[model samples]
Target: MHSLFILSVMLSTAVAAPFGLVAKRPLDDRDWTRSKRDGCPAYLTEGQYEFPHYMTQVSKSEPNLAFGPQYNGIFTPNDVSTVFSFDIPESRANDTCTLQFIFPRQEQLKTSSYAYEGTGTFVFTGYNPGNCPGPQTTYNNQPGNGPFPQFPPIHMEPGYAYTIDVGPCSVGAGTCVAGMTSTNDTYFSYFQDKDSCPIGIYTSYS
Candidate 1:
């Protein structure tokens, strides 16, 4: 009975996604390059930079004015950047997963800055799983794909992984505040829970 409940929920989610959760193929070595693949960024070439690189920055509140750059104060707004690479092994090529970009608690920011519930965006770039269709515009990847095809949200295969380039995107477009730098962006690969071909990956850019 318990299993049936879970199955029902999964089915519901699959029905919601358009692409469906199954894939016809996996990316090969040639698939990873620009010549063979269309929509690759200018920075991506035959053999130069790799797939993943970290993007980081730091800011604080207080009033030292000495520690790098002050954003909202050491307590107002802060920023940090890092890169990560993942390997999705062929063994678990057909599973479901999700990549999330967590943010600092609202209470952690100054009262002046703590204005909304979800008021930030993360800038992102890098190689996208071949299953995801696109010309690869904007730092934030949208209209792309994730692991789960049928489900609106993306899913990831347990073993197979892709690298992403991430960074802190400035908010408001105004000058950097005393202690706040901006927000972080991230992407993800996911497996939709719809059909038989169950392995795939995509990213998040908003």
Candidate 2:
């Protein structure tokens, strides 16, 4: 009877899917039905996306732990990364888009020379399941933790804007959902806004 009761309790508390309530569904990567085009879509307008609080941060070691504005990462020094999402509507599927990132000039630590100036980027196809970044999101607006991010290809600059054609990553459109990974570089990294400037990854169509 004791063993049976323990199993029953475990079954009742499940994660996502059939665990308890909310259903976690993977991104649908169905083959696109629309014809591929060489030129940009006639209807494609410029897309500039920015998240003020951004979504939260994530830690590779502790996947489930939450860290944001107030708190840092999972360690004393705290290893954290921010994930930016570019959620294009299903209406704008099959559209070629540009993935660009901008890190303002003033955000970095004042120095004669530094390595964090040359940052990196990565792309993914998912969205954050937790709440958006905010005062309530985490401690010290540090950066929250969720899943993990990987990227060794994209190279970025500080105060200068560079873009690349990464789409339609949403091959079939299918309510294209993509993300940009911001991994740590130096002790003081870029990406965080300056005094009044906003630093982030942008999605634009031209």
Candidate 3:
């Protein structure tokens, strides 16, 4: 009877476990940089640069894990883009999920030498496979105003792979400093249970 009880408890714990993914930097070139001759802006580029990747905390006691492509270079006005694609489990197809973009806090940015304050426009798009489904969902926002802009809860189709495109644009006068700093790690968190997300992930700013 005790063994049965233990099995039931384990099952329930697994069911209640949070489902999500964290963003991370590349391992090989984890500490590299781009210069003006190498495509970075002369005035904006400084310090070490790293490739963008997705990460997840597989174990609570361990640090975040990194995955996905290792795109080189920096985020410049001419090319401020990064893409992350992931698959949703079939079990989550009916469940409501929330997508969030997590940015480093202002205090954290101050610690980085390459950090800069400026206005920039970012375009986010979710694409369906093969273009079979027309009219994909998209979100656009200004990153300079604040951090943690999130999309409304969505019902994602299970067993399907979805791609998220992040394109940052510089507005007039101000330079778009998206993906500019090495100290800053931009994260995209996917929550299967919306309530499981911490209060800090939600922001009042648009």
- Best-performing candidate as measured by lDDT: 2
Q: All models: lDDT?
A: 0.21, 0.31, 0.20
Task: Give lDDT tens digits, candidate 3, residues 76-178.
Answer: 2222333222222333333332223323222222122222232322233222211111112111221121122222122111111121111221111021112
Q: Which lDDT tens digits does candidate 2 get at residues 71-108?
A: 11111113444444334555555455444443334432
When sorted by lDDT, best at the front, the candidate numbers are 2, 1, 3
Give the range of the ten consecutive residues with the poorest summed lDDT in model 3: 1-10
User: Which runs of model 1 end up more than 4 angstroms from their true locations?
Assistant: 1-82, 104-119, 128-206
Off by over 4 Å in 3: 1-68, 71-74, 106-117, 130-206
lDDT per residue, candidate 1, 1-206, as tens digits? 00000001111112123232233222333332333333222222233212211111222232222232112111111233112222333332232322222121222212222222222232222222322212222213222322232222222222222221122222101211000112222222121211221121122222
Q: Between candidates 1 and 2, name the one with more favorable TM-score.
A: 2
Question: What TM-score should be assigned to candidate 3?
Answer: 0.28
Clashes of each: 49, 17, 2
Tally clashing residue pairs in candidate 3. 2
A best-first ranking of the candidates according to their TM-score comes to 2, 3, 1
lDDT of 3: 0.20
- List TM-score per model, in order: 0.21, 0.44, 0.28
